[model samples]
Target: MIPPRSNRSQPLACNILRYRDLNRIERMFNRLKLFRRIATRYDKMAKSFLGFLHLTAAKLWLPGFVKRG
Candidate 1:
């Protein structure tokens, strides 16, 4: 007995927008690196470094609210 062949003509569905999201995230990290404290190993303690990272991220996020207001 021979097996039936499946349709090969249909194109695979893809999410192109995911790549755009990834690109935006990459850009955000690149922007984050622009800050001297985050870019360099200035903070010796991990807790202090993480706190500064969150502060930097908040600074980056605050502009959107400023624009809306």
Candidate 2:
């Protein structure tokens, strides 16, 4: 076992960049849950369920990459 440091004077620093990324990921999950099928998990098979999930995620992600004509 490693010994703990005795001189703990300052509070721990948070990584702002990592926290921002985590927040973005959490928000994306919240958005995904807005879809009824995904929230209910209607598919019984793992392969089909995963495929549907990928399609749903792509549907959410594609608009950002695609431009409106």
Candidate 3:
């Protein structure tokens, strides 16, 4: 799969895809879509949208690393 690029011109090619990575990314997007704000593009600015996206991603990622007692 093509990876993210700093500029919007075009994405660069990447190494071979792993099934596990693809699965995780798909799941992440599915979870992201569950948030109406994110799915509907409510943020008018790209920066704000990206900030919220990063916030959402961080929330999703936390459970994996945090341990419960």
Candidate 4:
């Protein structure tokens, strides 16, 4: 079946603020890539990588919260 189209015939919604922030976002992402594991992602296990991502997020959002190995 064919998908529906808008009666207004307008283009898809977009965020001008988000588009303007793309450069800054890219810079932040590049800076965040300094961590070796995050950049390479060598962990073969999904759980391990997920744990790594969670830990990274925790560290970023909750400053000074250290994850004990």
Candidate 5:
């Protein structure tokens, strides 16, 4: 959410929750960029790239669901 500037005649209302959610999603993309393959767009085919992207997302997400003994 963009904050209203002093010079603006009409300022828009920003939802704090929506802004926080957007921030979280942006952070996730930033994290994804940390992978060299993803950051560099090494895969030429869209299908393969999307498959790898899902795999990468699972790698990042699975830890929370799986329990370690």
Candidate 6:
């Protein structure tokens, strides 16, 4: 996977197909469709909504991405 390039208009969006370090892969998850689902969620508390959304995204995505990773 490519590292972030700060000079761009936006941070690079990509999934890490392979990585020597797992932590490095974690940093790239935002480019993934799963984690991005948080944007659509609604909850009584803003923090509650965002936290659960992230958890759901991780639960759904981690299995799929981890397998490919």
TM-score of each model, paired residue for residue: 0.71, 0.76, 0.67, 0.49, 0.77, 0.33
Model 3 C-alpha lDDT per residue in residues 1-69, reported as the tens digit of each score: 546666868766665466558978899899999989999999999999999999999998899999999
Alpha-carbon RMSD, each predicted model: 9.3, 6.9, 10.4, 10.2, 3.7, 9.9
**lDDT for model 6:** 0.62
State the local distance difference test value for candidate 4: 0.70
lDDT of each: 0.82, 0.83, 0.87, 0.70, 0.90, 0.62
lDDT of 6 by residue, 1-69 (tens): 666777878887766555436655575554443443454554668898768766775675677656553
Model with the higher lDDT, candidate 1 or 2: 2
Clashing pairs in 6: none
Give the per-residue lDDT of model 2 (tens digit) for 1-69. 223345767646666677788889899999989988889999889898889889999999999999899
> Which regions of candidate 4 fall more than 4 Å away from where they truly are?
1-15, 20-28, 64-69
Error of 4 at 12 (Å): 16
Count clashing residue pairs in model 1: 0
- How many angstroms is residue 4 displaced in model 1 relative to the true structure, after the best TM-score fit? 32
Deviation of model 1 at 59, angstroms:
0.5
> Alpha carbon lDDT of residue 4, candidate 6?
74
Point to the candidate with the largest lDDT. Answer: 5
How well does candidate 2 match the true structure in TM-score terms? 0.76
Pairing residues by index, what is the TM-score of model 1? 0.71
lDDT of 1 by residue, 12-62 (tens): 555567767887899999989999988996999999999999999999989
Compare candidates 2 and 5 on TM-score and give the better one.
5
Candidate 5 or 1, higher TM-score: 5
> Between which residue pairs do clashes occur in model 5?
none
Judge candidate 4 at residue 36 and give its lDDT.
81
Tell me which residue pairs clash in candidate 1. none
